[model samples]
Target: MYNRKDKQLAQKILTFSCELEEGQNVMLQLVGLNGIGLLRALVEEARAMNANPFIRIEDTEIRRILSETGDKNFWKNQAEADQLPLMKKMDAFVGIRASLNIYEQADVSREANKAYADYFVDPVHFKERVNNTSWVVLRYPSEAFAMNARMPTQRFRDFYYKACLLDYEELAGAMKPLQDRLEQTEHIRLKGEGTDIDFSVEDQTWIPCFGKRNIPDGELFSSPIRSSVNGYISYAPSVYQGKPFDFVKLDVRDGVVVDFDSSNNEALEEILDTDAGARQFGEFSFGLNPVIEEPMHDILFDEKIYGSNHLTLGNDYEIAPNGNESNIHWDLVCIGADVYLDGEKVREGRTFITDDLKGLNPENLMQ
Candidate 1:
């Protein structure tokens, strides 16, 4: 039954997410063990579609070592010679990470990580694959992940499956009204515990993601017009790049981060200083995943916590570009936000109040 569930997920990934067709090339990248079951299933499903499936299994420790030791020229060559060429030949990409240690890269310097992102990640994956290929990235359930979620391994697996197997078609249907409202909205305000922020999404695209881009996905995202964001935000407890953060706060002025603080202030400073765009807002989104109600210290789940809102501090999606580009696209989540769209209160905390958008509230979506 466990492996069967994996097979079902693999089927969904190929058929629904990637939309893999016969003879198309798909590159599946797995970051750790414990996801071999799903990998096998993905291969099987891809072959069933007569699609060519290629696999790349990576070790986190090795990745950390390379990031720590590799230089500018090394990363440039790696991307230009290896990853970028390989990615260009692919029709779709699926990245599955089930790392035994999320903190494996903790000792790697921010400078090194930034170089890798600039030279390798930005050009190869973010620019080429993201804009060209049908791609989806997700974390596979494992004991390490369960520990981070603060749940028993078995219980967390159950939660994972339930969330991932949601009726996304129904959710997508439910999202239309909110999408309509957001598209028409020019100004927006968000208020919650220690959070009061305002931004503009005028003329920006509101992307409703239910199942295609991400598993366990239920969010509508739009990029803030660069230079339109103002005020401050207090994010919920979260983790980024394998480090835990608490009481993260940022004060923005004209879309740029003027002041920021967190449990590790030094780290926050380093991250924001990655590039000019790293200090500006790139994406704003509302979380509507009914099954996910709390933080797991993992952005994949926490950013989709029902009733939550998240903001990204770096690169915007090509589909909804704000012209703020960086090697990073970090998402910071905050719960308990009341949303106002163009001065009209549409959502009071976690519940959508407007008639047209009420279907997106958890109570209705749970049905």
Candidate 2:
């Protein structure tokens, strides 16, 4: 018997998150069928609502081999099959990743990786997925994820679900104050140990993400004016594209990354070189999920850790078009950073200093 909780989660994604309507076509992309129970549940829910659901399963090991053998041309044209017609046809897309190994691609050479990513991965997969249909991406629990969180098997499972299946409706209701704050504010400043930065969001768009585009989402984002950023910022340890990096320090002046340093210098250079916009700011968001408390280097969780804030350096989101364009959109997180709105403290060290966000305080939420 499939677990009832898994089915419930699927129903939440289909009915609540994706909001699939009758006759809509939804696509499910699974990794190796590791979470087939949830997949089956999703199918049942889709049919019940008179929505059509289809699936595509991928094997990472096979892709790793392809990466080792394929050249630039191979990847450039790889997404032709799906990108041409199928992606446009889908009304919604749900991706479930249950990869057993997060470091499976760590050994892939940087030259090949960069070439393929620049030429193929960006235009084929990411661009369409973001611009065409409603999509939500999430990761299923694996031993690797548990280990990364430094928790035991059952303990991590509990933590994972607790974070994902949060009361997002309540979250949405409480986010109004912050959303309004960002919408009205023009100049925002950030400061913390090893970080101090200034940026202006004058006339920029503020987007509230509440478990729609990304699972475990509880943040509102805005774009920094392309020429209004000045100063340095630091970030916590994070893994990107199968590599571990930490202590990311960026030197930004007039909204450009002049010089940057990190624990992994080579990877840093590769990411910054992804495109022209890769060196500039894309998105700035405040983490509001009281349930997510720690940084385990997983962006989906860390970016939402209570009182945290993440700044992206790459392509601007479609919702908040910053007039910046790039194929890369990398989220770099700053833990315990104090955020200032018009020179007033609003967030400090994993807690909101403002009274409007009292509902988000840990004491209030856990109660």
Candidate 3:
């Protein structure tokens, strides 16, 4: 049986996030069995909206098998012949992922992962689904998710619902001033322990994201100028493609990553070497979710931690493009970074000190 929160979240996804209209089709993608309750709720919610809902279930284990066995041509065929057509036809998409074990795909070879990402994920989902359709993607609370968050199972569930069900309209209003400020700024600087970076967002558009593209979201993002990023940044620990990374540091010169180091060096090298764009910065953003405060080994959650900011490597979003494109879009987070705009210190660690932006601080936002 589905819980009330599941139904509530389902309603939000359909009505608020995707805005599923009558007679339109929305694809619901479930990545593991643990999200079955939420999936059922979404289906019911879609039907109530008079929208035709399509289901596509995927398992991480099955995906690992395919990656290990399939060749380049195999992934290409799957993307072209199967996934792209369906994604192109959909009016909206809602993806809910869960995992029994976070390391299910940890052992897949770099070559195989590259093929899967290049042929299948990039073309079908990133290009077609993201740029074309109204969509929202989030992870369902599961045992593995709770463990990653360092919380008990039931407590994590409660926290997830609370975080995801915030008053997004109010949050968006609070973010408006910051967005305006970003639009007017030319150079932005970041400083923290083991991190010092600065870049130009001159004419780039700043997008205020509040519970639209991503659930539990409170961020404002804009891509740096394609050739304007310089200086190094040390990111907090994170997980990518089911593998853990810590103390990840990158040295940048003119937007390209000149050198890098990480706890998992081999995997980090694979990501940076994916393509030409992979070495350059793509998206730069501030995290403003008041409820979340720490890394959870999940990008979806960690990228929204209130005291943090994240920079993406490779593949800028269509909404905020810096002309950097690649098979990977990695969001590396840096916590407690002081932010400066045009030489003015606007944020000191987790607190926004600017008068106009003070409402975004955790204390004020939670009020």
Candidate 4:
């Protein structure tokens, strides 16, 4: 069952993600094996807010097929004819992800993943679908996910729920200083143990976004100039869905990932080698959610961690001031690292100066 707190949390999650407006039609996609209760609660919240809500539950087996079939033509056509229609019809979309098998099988084809990536980069549909929607992707805990996190199932859920309840306004406020700093500097460098990278920003390339009607968890993001990255980046081991990628070290030069090595994961190499644009940098963003604790090895969850951090490679949504090149956007998460714009540390391990921000309603700041 569901308790009042759980229901409240569900509503808050919906509110933060969808921000349903009166009379808008909201569509939610829930992975069938996880978070049905939360989905129901979200429906109720949408109704209460006078918005029409629709819920579609997807089976994990379908995902397995897409990951295994390497069926590009089918998905490419579907994106143009089917998914695009739904995007135009809906006011907003909220995706609730809960996977029963994160790494259902290690034998699945990396080529299939590449095929899907290629399909997304379809020029006509990518512009139409990505640019027109107000959307969000969020996560819920499941037993399989807990196993990957190496925590009890209940503990994982507790951490997830607690993180979701964090103050969005405070989180947004904390990111302002960093955003301002990025606006002032043309080049930013990232340095860490086993990682040293430098990337140049376009003269007028930064995107500054405030909270909008649909996306409540607001943050600033932009695409790095296509050929502006240099040096190496070592991705810490991460588990996606349920599959794990070994530590990956990429040697980037002239805005492209020219050389790459992974401890045990050859699939990453295959991805970067698939296309010219695939290896180039796509998007850069700083996480703003204060409630997100630490690196839990999940990109979706890790990117939302409170404090200031940036992600490069792959562009999905049409972020403001976007480079608008590749349709394949992959988000890489980094945490517990200092973020500097020019020379000042805007984020010292997740804490940002909140006093310098304007239009930040304190009443709405996250606790």
Candidate 5:
């Protein structure tokens, strides 16, 4: 009952995540809506590969509970439980997201959510997850996500599915030129109409992650020094956790966000004020997927837009090979932005230098 596209998607997941090792234990957490089919297929694929797989499904009601109850202790306990066992047992973890609204629980007190968020992913958990497990964060489509992307539901769903089918190898190949440039550069600067930022990378800090834990695209990323950034960035008309932020501008000095400004939202203020570490830079990455044509307003999709890139402040997931700090992570994406490494233009306006890296082609993978 599987279509060829579905099979291709499964293969892409397996290849990119490096999940075929015999006797490896696999754990997957599926959020409601986006990744149901892919999760089902992935579970089966894991079994066929001789891996023991466990799956968990999380629903929106959980958000409702944390929001309505205002119980930080409950989430704290839950966080402990969720992470400790994974740290002890699982060899691989895969997260499949299909969220459209991050602020669905905005009604919850910011203080409570901040406490919960702070505790949810403990430092120990991050270290364990990053070091031992071969992990991946992948996307599935949903109506809410389609709306965020400004695309018709069916069309966007098709686009995501097609993107999922891209060949992992080809995508990595297309990114080699850019990776080469970034690896050789010591400092990279980002400037825009309302933003000017500069940061230095440790020698060999920028790394190219490919062939595992990523697919359909490859990116160059690094963990910047905790307090080394200087400048301002404005992200308006962007939504996070289902909440919209208008004209959000942040001023940075020595890598800590010194001043934060937002129009039409006080929630943004609360987020940055949560902790001293909240404003720290966590990860910097450039998107190499050429098929992603525009910003969908969803970090999962937008962060992968070809030639586009994003810098996440706070809480380095340690997903990249590089090391960064903090436990509060927020991704700010820039669309159609020009990306450079050592004065070489690797991407401009959503296109890579490689011609084959255009569009979501299964054969090319780079797109």
Candidate 6:
């Protein structure tokens, strides 16, 4: 039997998250786990609103088998399939991730995984899905994810729902001042233990994503000028594809990561060397979700930790384009960073200093 909560969450994804419209066609993709009640709710919600909903589920077991055996060229040919055409036809895309095993691909070597991703998954998802559709990606609470978070299974489920189903309208209204400030700022600076960085976002558009592109989303993001990033930043541990990157440090010189390190030093270097744009700073953003307090080994959640800021490497989204394009867009988070904008100590330690942003003052919103 499916829980009523599943149906509730699915309704939010269709109605609020993706804004299912009349006559629109949506593609729902479930990974590694199933939520049949949520599936029913999504289909019914779509049809009730005159939208078409269809699902294409992919299990991790099958993907693991493909990655474990498929050669580089085999993956390349798979990429050549016409999935792009079909994906482009999608007006809305919703991806549900509830993996039973976080380390489901532990047997697949890193090199094999990278090659397969470069050819197949990355091309279709990044090049096609991200830029084209009204999309939202979210993780369903699962035992494995709860274990990674060091929380009890049921407690984590409660946390997940509370974080995802925020009153975004109130949050967006509160962020208007900050968003306006970002639009007019030329240079921004950040400082903290093992971190001090400078960058400019003079003309770049600033986007405040409150439960839109990402469920549990509370961020105001803008890409710095590709050649304007300077100084260094030490990020808290973050995970990518089930691998933990801890104490990740990067030295930026003229917008490029000239020096970098992480728990897996060699792997970090290889990731940055994916392409030229991979070495350049592609994204800079703040985390504003007050309830999400710490890292959970999940970017979708960690990147919204209230007191953190994430600096990403690789392609910047068109919403705040910096012209740095690559197959990678890794969001590395820095905790307890003292953020300074245009010489003013505006926001430090996730707590705000500027009165202009008093609208977002946690005291006002959290209750």
lDDT of 3 by residue, 71-159 (tens): 78999999889989999999999998877887788887878888898888888988899999999999999887898899999999999
Overlapping backbone residue pairs in candidate 1 total: 0
Quote each prediction's TM-score.
0.98, 0.95, 0.98, 0.83, 0.85, 0.94
The lDDT, on a scale of 0 to 1, for candidate 1 is 0.88
lDDT of each: 0.88, 0.83, 0.90, 0.62, 0.65, 0.82
Stretches off by above 4 angstroms in model 2 are none
Candidate 1: residue 251 Cα off by (Å) = 0.8
The best candidate in terms of lDDT: 3
Better of 2 and 3 by lDDT: 3
Candidate 4: pairs in clash: 102-241, 102-242, 102-243, 103-242, 167-366, 289-306, 314-329, 314-330, 315-329
Which 10 residues in a row give candidate 3 its minimum summed lDDT? 97-106
lDDT per residue as tens, model 2, 1-367: 4577778788889888898999999998887556777788888889999999988878889867777667777776776655436777889999888777777777787677766776666775667767888888888877788999889988998888888888888888888888888888989998999889999998898888889877788888888998999999999888887778967999999999999999999988987887798898889888878788888868888898888888889888778878788767778888887889899988877778679967777777666
**lDDT of model number 6:** 0.82
Q: Worst lDDT window (10 residues) for model 5?
A: 354-363
How much is the lDDT of residue 86 in candidate 5?
58
**Model 5: per-residue Cα lDDT over 1-367, one tens digit each:** 4445656676666645655577887777786655677777887788888888888787765755765675667666766677666555888877776555556665777666666665665533465666777777776667877777778998977887766555556666656665666666777666566766777765645666553664444565777766667887765356664567655778888887888877644777677766666677778887656567676666655666665567776777544433444555777776555545556554454555544333322234532
- After TM-score superposition, the amount by which residue 59's alpha carbon in candidate 3 deviates from its true location, in angstroms, is 2.2
Deviation in angstroms for 279 in model 5? Answer: 1.6
1 or 5, greater by TM-score = 1
